[model samples]
Target: MSTFQLPSSTATTSTAYSSDEEDTLPYPGELSRSDFLAKDFNPEAYLSSLGRNRHQTLEDLRSDLRSRSQLLNQELLELVNGNYEEFLSLGADLHEGEERVEGVRVGVMGFGREVGGVGKVVREREREMEGLLVEKRRIGGEVGVGRALLEVDARLGEMEEGLGIIDRDEDEGDGFDEDDEEVGGEKGSSPVLRRLQRHTREFLLLTRMVERVGSSHPFLLAQQGRVDAIRKTLLLDLAAALRQAKAAKEADAMLGIVRMFSDLGAEGEGVRVLRGS
Candidate 1:
């Protein structure tokens, strides 16, 4: 008790400050460090704002700071004096403090258990979301395949509806020479032959798309019979067009259809053309 003495407030108030604490120091907007430390403080903008807000002179600012410092010192001194006896006996009063500490530890342990349970629920929900996302992607892929199959079916239907209009009767005639020329090079070709060539090209394009989808794709495999029937129909129309060209003695037209069969790698059909059937 003899070793401890209260600090003198008069001496504290009289203590000299560091050189930087002097009011004559140059600072941005002549503001104190406490003002610069304030929330949302922007020194550049605050300095700019000071031009329009210079109501408080430097002398007034210094007076207000000095008075606030004195008030804080007085309050601190009063607080210390009022609690001096209890502050001295603080070590003796901490005898039952360990029980309070144990109670706080138990509360923290209970809170940790609750947090752990919540974490487990969050992880479980994350796993479920991942599974649902994978299933959604799979269903989306199947839907895309189904739509492609519908397009193939629609095109085949159009080809079937147009099949009976082609002149199949005039195809029984003498065979033409199996010479080659591009169909693209000929103008003034027969309209019936032109339509047949266009449908053949379109059917081949559909075949390519189906092949790219894969041979064993379930959607393609299911429609394989209809696809094959359309292909056979295109081939028969091509054969008939070759004979009709021979009947009309359109030498250029026969040459173009012969070239088409060659490009198709169907030399057997070209052989039938040479055989007059």
Candidate 2:
């Protein structure tokens, strides 16, 4: 028998879209159509698997070992070059909190930027919703109740529920300060903080839903606008509360709080407090 090499399969599951094809990127918290069509597309599960896997493949295992060995060799070379005592002295300095004294972490502001980005998305969704309502009003008279309209109504209801959660959050009547010592507990322990976080989460979830539904749906777009408006109004109310506190002769307390917010990179929030004052 003659030995022969088999031809490759005609199907190309691994190849990406052709270069000539126009590429489309996904919006935040969204996946591209290609991602949905992928055989393995679960991002959370993929991340978990990578975290759990010591060696995902032979190549991965080899690469990891090589990296560790190279690091060891570098460390040994440094020690031979009389850097070991220097490293030891550096470690002792860190133990005495010399590294922590720099205080650079206070101005990072990464989390504030993330929250601001979310707030911007929420505002954009609100504008989209206004356009949707205009469209719905335009077409409502011509076309009566239909399946598409019903779907829009359902999405609108979900958006309403999301907003309602934020409104009802204040009904608890705890009246806690924004910088209250009581609300500074560990994650999930402080009721006031939890409520605030929940409100943000709801906004984020609704924002994602609106994006997924697309800007075509008018009711959703309008509802999103309402949600954003409500959140801004709520924040303004907080600013007003700060103003009231200052009026009540809590200047010493309010000033410190406002300054703390500013130092923590929440300059907008600090401005709001001062404006309220």
Candidate 3:
């Protein structure tokens, strides 16, 4: 083996790499090459993505609004329909009650005397009054129906206003051009609109009917009152006859008068005839 000269430790230190070599390595805090490349990404592409997101959000909002609108409309319709039924029922009840009262009035009139003939006349008048009252009640019912129709119309208007707000929002999102105009114009004649229109027309007709009938009822009631007054007068006359007479003949005459008045009051035939007029 040939003996070689050993390198000294001082020589190895003298050939050391510079600090610049350390600078070439990436630091833990520094960005990677990929991160730097991604820094100048396209803003337009990002914005387009955001726009898509917004579109989806708007669509969701519209769907929610439409659902809410439908629910509200259904509830409103039910309420209006219920109100109409209640009013109609009330009016019928009133009519029936009035009829019963008139009958009772006639019965009371019949218990009087006949000698004066006043009792008979009063009973006839009461019968006429009952008929007039019936006619009046019928007319009143018509008026109530008309009022119910008007209420429904008013509710429809309110729902339309709410729908308008949603329409405005949609218009803002999608520019309303000629196509939109065409759609809107045609929508007015759609099946749903047609149905609503039919309902409105029916309501209007009912209202008009009520107005016509209402005008006649008060007059009829006035006539009825006159007949009632006559009945009351006859009742008074019979009562007087009952009190004044001691003789059986006088009592018999009074009884005949009472019977005549009772017959007249039976079903308010006179009142019915007046009402028919």
Candidate 4:
């Protein structure tokens, strides 16, 4: 028997077999136009599923990191601001001390003129001048310390701010999964996320560099040296003022030491001592 099938029946059979094969074949959940067109898409679910596929963790980690970074930055900024106020206070104290030093220098210069039995008065002025010079030295040292502290605080604040920015970028980037294929009709890679990551990396590097520079700063050392010099000068000036006062007392008793000889003569010596020569 010749088993010849009708042409129409054979065509139908081929179509049925093709359809069955297609139904049995596995269909990967590829993004389709229908998925994009769906209005009720859950972004959070999409992100989660995308993360699962890409091995990316949840967004909670990024959020926690960002919160911590912000807190740290805020605290550091407050510390820096506090240090600035302290610096200002130290500067004011230094200025006051400088004024006192200037007053002492003027009094010593004036005493050398020896006006109308002013020898006793000059001796009293010298004592006061000596005390002021000592105070000036102490205040100068305090100012130098304050300045160094302020510099360190400022650098720390800057580093914290940079870290905060980096953390924020990380949180934002965590939203997009790198391995997730474009779902639906979405076009191209995310430019915003890429830019954010780049910026964060740059900021982190800059902060680290600044911190390194600040930690081993030479300017702070130089300022400390200046403070030490000023302190030493103050000590020398105070010693000289006391000596002049003693000399004036001796001249008063001897009556032979005239105003010109005792007062005017000591002027050159006083100037030299005050200048730390």
Candidate 5:
């Protein structure tokens, strides 16, 4: 029902009221909506506050309440009518709320699966990259080994070539120095024998390194025969040079040659040559 107000108490002229309409008589400007707004509002108490002035009969009050209720009902009906289309739309959407929620759930699940698949692919790629890195390191190590072996082989070849060149020069001159011991000066090495000393020392050191790698190392093993040939050729050259120095009576040259033998790890061979000479 629509809200109404009761008037406040004030001076009012007395008019004897019919018992049936005792508190229902009207008093002009004495009622307002604020009268009913009190926290403890009561219709009987509000009517009694009017004192002797009567407004109307009890049946009239009942009639006013009925009218207010009908008016409120009419207003509520109008409100519902005003947004009738929106109310229908809301009802329809609510009816389909479950299906919409299910669709959203399915979409989320599919996205999650895709994300998981991408993560799996990324992990697989990471593993592949790790394997590639390991392979790269192995290849790099092998390349380094190849370079070392190449260096060793090249050095050996150069030394062998030098030996041949020196041998050719040996028959060309006396190949002696002022330090030659044949003239009775203090013993000292000639230039020709000094070259041989260097050759023996370097070759022996290189060979020792190769041997330490183990005879079973495939690359060095394959080069073993060549290494042995170089060693044999070098020893022969040393022996011939020793013989030539003794024939020339060059003790200093011979001393240097024997030292070369020791450097080549062939001191036993030098001892035998000395015995024979």
Candidate 6:
């Protein structure tokens, strides 16, 4: 084969591989570059810098990942601690519930589980309620009786007032002139006599009530006695006034006077009028 000769340089030349030439050499893989700029391109050094950049990025990523993982672990630990504290509280509450259940069991055993005692207590309470109802009824009856007595007392007061007015009118007069008394009695005696008759009837009604309730209320019996005395005094005074008024044909007064005498059991005085003398 004929050898091919390259052109010789005029100055000294190095036979060693230049950095640019080494960069241009075919690597293990199919890669190439411009031989003129291969020294400046420096592919190996560029690749080393790229590898360093990749490693530095990987290291920084790993450090950040480690710090994040540490934070996650701390959060997990706190969550676990919180859950553990809740678990402990729940355990204590469960223990208290168990104690309360045990106490209930002890109480049940102490009472011998007798339901009869509870029933007996309920029955006694019912009986006490019944007694209270009975007392309430008794009080209601007493209140009714008291109201009736009060009405009777009011009527008696009206009668007393009328009698007081009559007494005052009689006292103010000079004396009982038979003619004047006859004229006045014909006009005025109707009212007084009617009032007296009404009082007598009312007194009889009151006496009956007093007789019925007097044992329970002793004061009512005393009141009845006073009423009876007043009735007798009023009848005697009214009879005397009528006898004086009868001379001038005071028929109504004479009739009322006779009725009062009969009520007082003074039959002798009542007989004098019945004979028309």
Top candidate by lDDT: 5
User: TM-scores of the models, in the given order?
Assistant: 0.51, 0.26, 0.19, 0.19, 0.47, 0.40
Shift of residue 104 alpha carbon in model 2, Å: 94
Superposed Cα RMSD, model 5:
12.3
Number of residue pairs clashing in candidate 1, backbone atoms closer than 3 angstroms, sequence gap of 3 or more or interchain: 0
Query: In angstroms, what RMSD does candidate 6 have relative to the true structure?
Result: 16.9
Count backbone clashes in candidate 2.
4
Q: Clash pairs of candidate 3? A: 113-238, 114-254, 114-257, 127-268, 127-271, 128-270, 128-271
Clashing pairs in 6: 20-38, 20-39
After superposing candidate 6 on the true structure, give the runs of residues whose Cα lies further than 4 Å from its correct spot: 1-118, 165-189, 241-246, 249-257, 260-277
lDDT of 4 by residue, 1-277 (tens): 8897779989999999999998887543433435434788875786566556543345654664467568769988999999999999999999999999999989977776656358778788899999899989988876865665665445433333333422344434333445453332123423322322332333344335435545345654444443334333333333444355455554331222122123323445444443456
Model 1 over residues 1-277: C-alpha lDDT tens digits?
Answer: 3776457875565554444366656543434547756899985787566645666665776676587678778988999887886776774566567678889999999999999999999999999999999999999987877787777767666665556423334644212222333255356766665666666676777787787667698877887887777767767777888888888888888887887777666878977876886
RMSD of each: 22.0, 49.0, 46.2, 51.3, 12.3, 16.9
Worst 10 residues of 5 by lDDT: 8-17
User: Which residue window of length 10 is worst by lDDT in model 3?
Assistant: 175-184
lDDT of 3 by residue, 1-277 (tens): 9887557775565445445566575433311234324767664674464455443454654565477568769988999999989989999998999999999877777644443388678888999999999999988987775665455445333333332312334434322232232321334233333322232333344335435545355543343443344344444443444334323335444344344335444334322322342
lDDT of 2 by residue, 1-277 (tens): 9887444442332234442242453212312335435786886774465446432554664565477568769978977678777878878988777546545454447667888999999999999999999998978843643444555455444434544443434445434354544432333233433344444444455555555556556665666666566456435534554576568766654554454344334569868567654
Residue-by-residue lDDT tens digits, candidate 6, 199-261: 556556665666665635755655665576667666656565565657667776777677767
- For residue 276, model 5's alpha carbon misses the true position, in angstroms, by 2.3
Residue 34 alpha-carbon offset, candidate 3, angstroms: 99
Our model 1 lands, by Cα RMSD against the true structure, at 22.0
**Clashes per candidate (backbone, < 3 Å):** 0, 4, 7, 0, 11, 2
Q: What global local distance difference test value does model 3 have?
A: 0.48
Q: List lDDT for all candidates, in order.
A: 0.70, 0.54, 0.48, 0.51, 0.72, 0.62
* Better by lDDT, candidate 4 or 1: 1
Poorest 10 consecutive residues by lDDT, candidate 1: 173-182
Judge candidate 1 against the unseen true structure and give its global Cα lDDT, from 0 to 1. 0.70
Backbone clash pairs in model 5 (N, Cα, C under 3 Å; residues 3+ apart or in different chains), count? 11
